[model samples]
Target: MRTLRMILLAGMAASALTAPSAGAAEVTALDLGAATAARLAMGHVRFANGHDYNATVGFGSGAFHRPGDPPGTLYAVTDRGPNIDCAEIGAVVGMSAEALCAGDTAAKVFPFPAFTPTIYTLSIGDAGVEIVDALPIKTRSGRPITGLPNPLTLTDTEGAFDADGRPLTPDASGLDVEAVARAADGSFWVAEEYGPSIVHIADDGRVLVRYVPQGLEKDLAAADYTVKGTLPAILAKRKLNRGIESLGLSADGRTLYAALQSPLVNPDTAAYKTSRAVRLLKIDAATGEALNEYVYPEDEAASFTADAKAGKVKQSDVKISELVVVGQDKLVVLERISKTTKFHLVELGAGASDLLGSPWDDPKTSPSLEATPDLAAKGVIPLSKTLMLTAEGGPFPEKIESIALLDESTLVVISDNDFAITGDQTKVVRIALDKPWN
Candidate 1:
């Protein structure tokens, strides 16, 4: 069985997504169990509800690398702590389903209610992955910010509960950070899902300014950090929990690229589930203004041959997970289903339509951009894409949310383990291309 598995991985590694392929790509797997074991040994995590999750680091939320960082050294961020929806609360916590989940708002159970999201500096080597340093995301007052959902007055809000089935209050400062990009000055820009917001943090981990969709400023007024409503108003219509999930920063740190995880519920939820149009934005890093917006069409569900043969799947299953900047106007977009992942090289200049102020961005437009059946028929041109890599089956783990390039010819991918909520372990895969990406 081991020999057969190795042969399968070798074959899969040789498959290149782009044209003019070289030879087989080198593949390596790094297990993060050592970091988890080390954390447990030091008692780094304390569960308030008495439920020991035996959790992993959950470092796959986002990844970043400064221009001059050493090879094999990258930074990763964690999402909201170990949590499960209401449906599994009964079995996982051995508690009544109605106690915390049956109220006016359904709440997710957080085993570590006070857990804060953190940034980890990782060293990837032949032996395994190592955690060299860690930084906690905090507020200006130096108070660590929890991962709980924010209490917003304008848009939708999700509630949360502690492990003991105790309802937890919504915090305006809470952030469900999904992606991070480091600035030249050593500060950080993070993409979040709760307010579906973008936040700028200082070098010491203090939030400098948070930019949300227009009209959300009033909602986050009480937040300790400065809040700005600079993003387009239409972005507020994004599907719940499906917000900005991918972010990339230019080497000069003057521009940023951000993408929504899935199509927005422009017309309604039905349109969102069936739509292929995903919004990607190019923003001015200094001003937080969206300079341009382009539509990124996701792949059809039937295209994933192996996954479709197993069972039924829908277009909604495909989502944008991460974005990596490779050139001045070029990026690598990571989109995936649960079992299959694809990396596409996308260029921002020319031949692509910028829909910044078009009707597609207007909230009052009927049959919204997401609902439009044919954008080409309306003279709209989405970004042109070239497939760079298609990874599935052996050596590729599910829920791969973060990706980075170690060199011109090497790619690094990380999978989110959900803090071992379902017995999943955080895994990292390193792929050395036969030829350089340039």
Candidate 2:
């Protein structure tokens, strides 16, 4: 198979590779070329762990398309800023790990605490990818919002600190956005992991309405935008940092579907670590009301062919990163571990059990929905899933959090690169599938 590669070199020219046979698949990395508008200048930071932080704009957090946009145009959003755990900072700051973070192990230090989440318009072609425009997400007052963690009142929260080991106040408007979907009316819906919430933004990037789980409204009361407690309350059980990561919008933009990144802690953390039961929500786009919910059984680590080959044997490592709607009640879900990614076509219309108001939604249930191993034996039917593609090794990189259909037979994927904190460059890859998804 012919594989194309591109490295970001100043004034480097891009070349196309020969296409594979009709029945064979191909993967090619788009040459981002030189660092221009897409690159963020956060200066340099010497971490206590002997690692220097290199600033780069995280363009892969989420991606979407405007219905009437150019064929190769896509809009992408960035996540929060560069952050490291206190344990990582304690080592370099000459302080004990426990003492430096005020005994909160979940505490993190943001080197660039003011980095704002922004969206970019990209154009893809044979020459590579080009950044056409950018829009920084803003509040009602027109001020950009940071990516800092929110101080949740009803749900779990983490502490935020600065480079000097000083505590940083949490921002109610802070959002760790993971996915984006555009509506027919020009507004955008973004999935956030911090509130595990969904935010609606006007065409100009101004926050319109923010939706969160029940009882979590008070926490974001200080936010500049309107807040609604419209999601299921069980979502508060989402594992810290692993909330709603994937989102999909129906063709007509009347419905929205959100997928949890992992199983909920339901009863406790032990259940979350070993459970394969992830939740998917179908919401009313116009009202933010959760219409129904479905179980999305994430595969075990051993099932991911690439991870097995690499000997990474933890089922908890699997996560749903992105979703693409193909047809009515039909969508493609992106699941991945660090080194491997898989796409599965999921059907939610027939034969799937809706657990909306069932015992599974109740936190008091004895065997939390997540703790149940044999969901089928329990008469609980999950959404039907068929593996569409397995992307392993080469061309593909770690933390590929965004994907879009470039055409009926091809897909474009982007890696998060964690803002290049570890010296990894963000890569955009195009994959030609063996068969057309249409």
Return the top candidate by lDDT.
2
lDDT of 2: 0.81
lDDT of 1 by residue, 205-265 (tens): 9999999999998888878889999888888888777889999999899998999999998
**lDDT values of the candidates?**
0.80, 0.81
1-438, model 2: which lDDT tens digit per residue? 454443323333454333233222656678887754335556776645445656878789888765566778887888887877776655444455555477676788787888888888889776778988888889999999998989787888889876655788989999898988878787889999987899999989999999999889888999988989999999988998899989888888999989999999889999999999899999999999899899998988787766778775788899999998877878889999877787888888588999998999999988888988899988899988877766665666778899887666767899997777666777887776667764
Measured on C-alpha atoms, candidate 1 has an lDDT of 0.80
Model 1: pairs clashing at backbone N, Cα or C within 3 Å? none
* Candidate 2 segments whose C-alpha is farther than 4 A from its true place: 1-24, 35-38, 46-52, 90-100
User: Candidate 1, residue 30: CA error in Å?
Assistant: 1.4
